[model samples]
Target: MCTTADESGMTTLPEISLAKLTADETRGEERQRLETACQEYGFFCLVEHSIPKKQIGQAIEASRQFFALPQSIKERYSHAAQNVYPAVARGYGPLHGEILHPEAHTDPKELFGLGIENEGDRRPFAGATRFPDEASAPGFARSLLALQATVLNKVVPQLGTALADMIGMEQGWFQRHFSPPTLMQRVIRYPARGGKCGKHTDGGFFTLVLQEELPTRSLQVWFRGRWMPVPSLPDSLVVNLGDMFQALSDERFKSTPHQVAHSGLSDRISLPFFIYPDIYTRLTSRQGRHSFGVAEMMLRNMESVAAGNGAGRAREL
Candidate 1:
């Protein structure tokens, strides 16, 4: 367990290490603990995940390098200006370009998103990735892709298996539904102070976030009417369940509402990998009624985000 107290008081989130989460000796106990965390808080930090240190550094450096580019050059990748639609944008979005919380005036953030390079998959999020040419951001594509691959191939399946078990699914359940997962790799940079993305639940199965180590706590989770600040842990990434998880788990797991507050005096970068089932797949709730398609829910929420209004449940990918 990881618990910390700042000016906002004390907060605790389970710390589940992938090393133990998969080991034969500890898997059952750790998996049970993870399920309890999901039910109680829907958020936790992952530690001891064995992705290469070099790969992690490369991705972070590439993010900084790309974000450091001049505004004019960066704007060249703008989704709107580049003719890519908002529903499944795989390009850049300027500060205030995204509205995660409609009532929060403006979303004081800029972001770039990419994923799903399967050009032949004609689903909503399976479109080919559109990256900046090497001339624009040297090694940016290679580094990010390398790290993303590690997380997808190494980390996701392990976590997904645990999740499948949490919901009583048989073996290969995730594989059957997510053959071409609707994965979205989103990089968001929040400028220092005065911006609150508001409390909103993600509109997907879950999100695994690689947050920059910082002094101030920018991420917070809502529970029992209190805002619980998530602490920065060394060599750890954050994970949070989403509305889809809640629905599929018979709402046993809470899709805790969360937000990114000002990151003190410095800019903060959050690299979030949003995981969804295949776009064309329709999922039935645990109760055997009320079904929803991945594409339908996501596209509707994206529409809400673009219209400058509150994001629907599971509103972001």
Candidate 2:
């Protein structure tokens, strides 16, 4: 679906306007286009989604301010320090904290992760996220939570419904699976002179990325045994299917391999929402008996990575 090229000879990701797709007049055609993009490329750029640009800018600024805090203050919320029930994976991870690609090297990026905040939930990767003191980062938590709500309540559900439609399932079929889903928001900062965040596929169902504008293109996808740059586009979000989606779809869709090739010229910031189905919902493939819940698989993979076993290499997640 992404066949167009820009003046710089870089292939542009196929774009889908959410505004047009949501309208009654163009829903069907746009749905078909979305299906094609998923089956062919596993990635696409989303535009005109109705999310306010000003809010996104504010969220970015908040993230920058939080990351700019003193290392000791940030470490107070680190995953190693927080001891909440069910042990949710929400907190800051210093640069080279976890080895994403143990064979090559650890990732040269700092991460701040937060999940849907449910104080009463006792499920793994669920419940309240540790945030900085209000005095230190005023309104930071509120802004991020608002953005998370928008993505989970609006953007993700719309895409899930479309995907169900594409597979000839009833409308809301996939949406049902995501009831009380495990949605995680991650803010990554790759500093200048940092090494690449080595090639790996995401471990969730899908990921929606808001990449900050940078002087040089850094995101690249492996296609046809070679890596190709994914050009940055203003006022757009990049969406890509993950290994779970590919597995559940019986590989009808791809979980493309991608990586960040940090230019080492300027810092880069990216906000990604990793959406997953409910922790108890099972994933099954018509091709075999490979059925498992989203949270189960994700936790297994994360633990594997934390143990230095390199989970992404096992199943490309």
Candidate 3:
């Protein structure tokens, strides 16, 4: 379980080392505690994951190179008007493209997106990926491909297994549904600003974020009505649940609310890998007598939420 500063300070999320948990020396009690945290918080920091440290370093370096490109060059990878993977996105979002939280301060940040679309599968349901051309971002394709492969092969499967067990399902049950999973990789640059992005929850199944050190704060997760500040944790990834988990788990595991508050002083940068089920896939199982479609529910809530009379947000992922 996570521990907070008891002397009137805010709570900080617990940091777990994957190496220790996976070791034979780990105690059953520790595992149980870790599992409970996943059920309640749905967000945690991972250290000593198997991915090569250089891979993260390369990803960061490559993003800097991509973001430095001239506006005209970056426009080549801009989202197609009809592409819904990332709606309303420009080639690279400029500072303040959208405000996530109007109640708090606004953020001055721009972003670039890479869509992940799998080929060889004709199921209109599978997602797609968009890669920048070689000329525009030399070696970017190679770097990103290597990173994506690691995420698909390592991080995702581990989390999938843990999640299945967390929900009383046999191990690998979740993995089976995602043989060829869908993913989205976004590179965001929060310019030096007085205010930044607002508080909002992600719309996917889960997210794994890796960010570089910055002069200002980058991300914050809302837990039990209080905001927990997430500072830069070098050589680690920040993972959080999305709305899909809330529905699938029968509310056993919460998809916690989180947001990125404005950085009072300097610019910051972050890269988040958003993982979720295919948009076209039906979220409700056929075994049930009658059920609500996940997509339908999400659409309804988004419409209702936007209308200012939000259909109350669901409890779990």
TM-score of each: 0.93, 0.92, 0.79
**Candidate 2: 10-residue stretch with minimal lDDT:** 1-10
TM value for model 3? 0.79
Each candidate's root-mean-square deviation in Å? 2.4, 2.5, 4.3
lDDT of each: 0.79, 0.77, 0.62
Model 1 compared with the native: what TM-score? 0.93
Candidate 2 C-alpha lDDT tens digits along 1-317 = 33434345656578887776788999989988888778767889998876777778778888888888999998888987655433437888888886666574678888888888888677777878878877988767878888888887768877777765665555667767888677878888888765467777777878899888665667877665667777667788889888787777777787887888777477788888988888878767756635777767888878877776654543344
Candidate 3 Cα errors over 4 Å, as ranges: 1-7, 20-30, 81-91, 99-107, 117-130, 262-266, 284-317
Candidate 2 residue runs with Cα over 4 Å from true position? 1-8, 84-88, 286-289, 311-317
User: Per-residue lDDT tens digits of candidate 3, residues 1-317?
Assistant: 23344234867676666666556676345456557667757788877778887987787778778878887766666555324432432235555455454454334677776545455433322334455777778776677678878887877776666655665665656666666555657777766544355666665677888777653455766766667777776677888877666566666666777766555465455778877665455655322322455446445544543443322242221
lDDT for each residue of candidate 1 in 1-317, tens digit (9 for 90 to 100): 66767566766888988888889999999998888888788888888888876777678778878988999988777675433334336878877776777667678888888885666555566666667888889888888888888998888888877887889877888888877578888888888875457778887888899877788788888777777777767688999987788888877776788888875897787889999898789998768745898888888878877777766552342
Point out the higher-scoring one by lDDT: 2 or 3: 2
Q: How does candidate 1 score on lDDT?
A: 0.79
Using TM-score, rank the candidates from best to worst: 1, 2, 3
